[model samples]
Target: MSVCRQAARQWSPFSLGNMPLYRVCGIFALLSVGLISFTPPCDGGNILVFPVDGSHWINMKILLEELHARGHTMTVIRASTSWYIPEKSPLFTSITIELDEALEDFFELYLQEHMRLQREGGSAFAFFKITKDFMSMLSTAHLMWSEALGKILDDKTMIKSLMDSQYDVLLTDPAMAPGVLLAKYLKLPLVLNVRWITSGEGHFAIAPTPLSYIPVPGSGLTDKMTFMQRIKNLFFYSTVVIQQKFMVGPHYDAICDKYFEGGCDVISLLQEADIWLFRSDYVFEFPRPTMPNIVYIGGFQCKPAQPLPADLEEFVQSAGEHGVIIMTLGTLVNALPKEVTDEIASVFAKLPQKVIWRHKGERPSTLGNNTLIVDWMPQKDLLGHPQTKVFIAHGGTNGVQEAIYYGVPVLGIPLFFDQFDNLLRLQERGAAKIIQLGEVNEHRLEQELKELLFEKCYRENIQRLSRLHRDQPITPMDQAIFWVEFVMRHKGAPHLRTEAYKMPWYSYYNVDVLLVLLTAVAVSLYSVFVLVRCLCCRSRRKPKTKQH
Candidate 1:
């Protein structure tokens, strides 16, 4: 049969008219039941995804794909960043803001000024001042992005347009705090997907309690902080609280009042979120104490192996027995100081292994025979290859996950941010050694390389962790999809929420104990005073009676 004729015969309602009326009605009923069965329970619902670029969004893409496969729809709203290379798809529609362009321009101007100052032989004090100024500028740029996002969200027309679509769930990066308000206003299920670790305040509604708590995973050592450290931590938390209150809290409150009947607390809005998803694995971010509503669905960004590029394949093929060392500092911190680059080159020169370093822009002059510099690399593919042995990395979470996925040991040279914490976790797990940025000399680099290359324990430990990581009942992607669907199926699982949301800070910390002690002391002092007064009165009454 011709294709069109076959489709017509299958779908034509007029053809069914020839049958008995009862038979036609039964056919229509059966068709309706089939249609309902095929359709997903949810409608053409929407999801608002922010920071829609980078590895963070990769997992989100996977979830969207799953939902799409199941016959649902989503809309992504995000800031533009180069990290997210666009893949053309009809199912996905993206709304991107130009925040990255502004940030790029600001950083370039700041860099040019700082470089000029350095070229002018600026003093140490002057250099410090310039650095501080640059940091302030960066912070200001971040704040501006947040404010612009807030303005977009606050527009009545924009909110109504988005609401008209009747979105079922709002998924946002924890870095974008404005999402909480949008979710609250719409009265939708807000799922905060945390891409990185931070205090559970601000955008990180899914993180563990004691919001700013840092876990020293696998350390197997827990001790109380010294008094000074406790004081310092308290001061740091207070500062963060103050900054976030001004920058995010007030705007959040305003948005909530306009949308939520002017009757909601900002923190209550976050606490009432439908669910929280973290991108960290339990093995990596172990010892995390989170409520039932918070789910750890890490490694969703990881993928099975793919074929390596021809040039990379040939490069590895050329390196016979010594194998290859892959080095990267991630995408953001591409600019390494000249001293560090030179030291890395020197160490690579001494090693027998062939080194492939992903260095952007101009190459250093110290290139040696066994070394090759490339602007980029297939990091996971290389890690999976048998010829690839060691990863010298900056300890970014994605890089670390890839290394662990392939069971390749790492020599971490962490520079800043969570790099230190990641390296510490790896070191505790006995799968890696760290080279602090300040101490990245040729000697130390060489020694660390030697240990990673020759040490059997590092390899064994990594392989062990890889086994644990892989032994899960489902892939991280499957687990993530399940939880996301669970939320949709259940219509917001408020029962998973904890009592932490109800208590004040003082009460949560048992400051009520101090209050009780103080009250007892006051009562004791008052009793003593009453007793003394009674004795004085008795003495005075006795003297009066004697006189009479």
Candidate 2:
């Protein structure tokens, strides 16, 4: 700098050397060229996705989008009767399969009946009835998937083509098992985008889940269980076992026999997955044992709020100090039963706060001027909004995760499946309240809403959760993407997966070893005892002679 100053003083024209912008541009250009020259280009991997329809497809689609953005080629296998998974998409090329039966009505009926039984207070008769219904539903769904996959397998051309594609990893949600079966048939590395599987939650399938803490889905129990709670957990677990062995297993068993050299095990296949992008997090989920390959990417689908449409903004602004309450029952059921909706609507009508409800059913007569009923609302955007106060939810994983992400306290009306369990976790932490379907009346719902709205603790606790959830070193989405890429970079992640799944039950638990050791010790003791007795007898026999 001193030399430059001296030169500047000697020649005024030389002062143009102070033009650092030109120098900065030259340096930036050099760095850019260097980076371009040295940095290895992205080698896109081929990914095959087999996703279940409905909300499961939604999750798979998001993951596919991220993989697509990262330059990976994606192909999604969807069903012909799928209501949600679009045949045409910019994200991935979809291969639609033909289905003999459509399952939308079947699931809808099951949910309706389940909700009705829950509303009937879940009596013993109701419990049995619901169990029968669930099994029937489970059987039909699996049988459909099994047959669909059989058709695909029978088509030599399609099977050959999929194998020819040489996909790096086969990504699937194990809610149904065709994908796992297909992956095995194709000999591709498998990655599961999962929470629910055929049997129960994915954790129960792969992790060492003890009923002492890990509550079964639909069992409104938490990690800290009372004695009776443990029994209830077992009972719920029994339901899951019945679900697996009786309802879901036989259909897949047939498929396993048909294609696999030996009978295939869906649960075992699930355990063999290279990576499990589990849709849960410790921040939201109760602490439990997790496998190495299981990546908790909870709330990954949630993003920052975007601008609301004009009318929504105006309605939200109109709420002012009272703020708005938003309600949505995830993807499956657009509306609850008439009586339940009426009860909820009546409560919302009386509230000072404005309400935006995503209800597709007939409008309630009790719906008030303060409430706005729409077919759909931008859920995450509303949750992120400053004016949004409380979220009324059906306790879907996505909704509960989003609630945690946005720090919104929930007033949950869990209808079926894992909904109650999801809300139970939030309630255990005092971040939310659950009102069961049986007890959902105007008086009860109104009371719950008032408490959720007025209570400071609920807001504070959930916000604390939000902070912890946001405090991660890497975002959940990025972590998920990294593991997926990690699996692709290395053909499969067998090192991360446990070999215990391959072991027989006795071997896995070391029962055989324990029995062998026990037998050796017992035989040694018995032999020593017999020898000592003989020695004593000999001594006794000789003692008479010695005394003489």
Worst 10 residues of 2 by lDDT: 10-19
Once fitted onto the true fold, the runs of candidate 1 whose alpha carbons sit more than 4 angstroms away are 1-45, 52-55, 62-71, 80-91, 98-101, 107-138, 195-239, 246-268, 286-288, 506-548
Q: Candidate 2: lDDT over CA atoms?
A: 0.89
Candidate 2 per-residue lDDT over residues 1-548, each given as its tens digit: 59997876656532445655667578778989999999988789999999988877777777888889999999999998998998998988989999987789778878888888888896899988887887788788889999999999999999889988889999999999999999899988888899999978899988888889888887878788899999999998998988899789889998888788978878888888999999999998888888889999998998899999999999999999999999999899888889888988898989999999999998898889999999888999999999999999999899999999999999998877788889988998999998888999999998889999998999999999999999989898998899988888888899999988999999988999999999999999999999999999998888443553
Per-candidate local distance difference test: 0.69, 0.89
Candidate 2 error regions (>4 Å) = 1-39, 543-548
- Clash count for candidate 1 is 0
Error of 2 at 481 (Å): 0.7
Write candidate 1's Cα lDDT for 1-548 as tens digits: 99999889877775664677678878889999999999976554456655434455655676677767866677776656535535346667766655535554665567545544544453777556664664466356546555656667667787788889877688776554556666776777777676532222332343353423443321122223455555555664554445456544555455556556746655666677777776677677646556677666666667777888898788888889989999988765555767668878988988888989999856776779888888888887889898988999988777888888889999997654456567767788899998766567888889988998898999999989888888888887777666666766676677887776677878867899889999999999999999999999998888443553
RMSD per model, one decimal? 8.0, 3.3
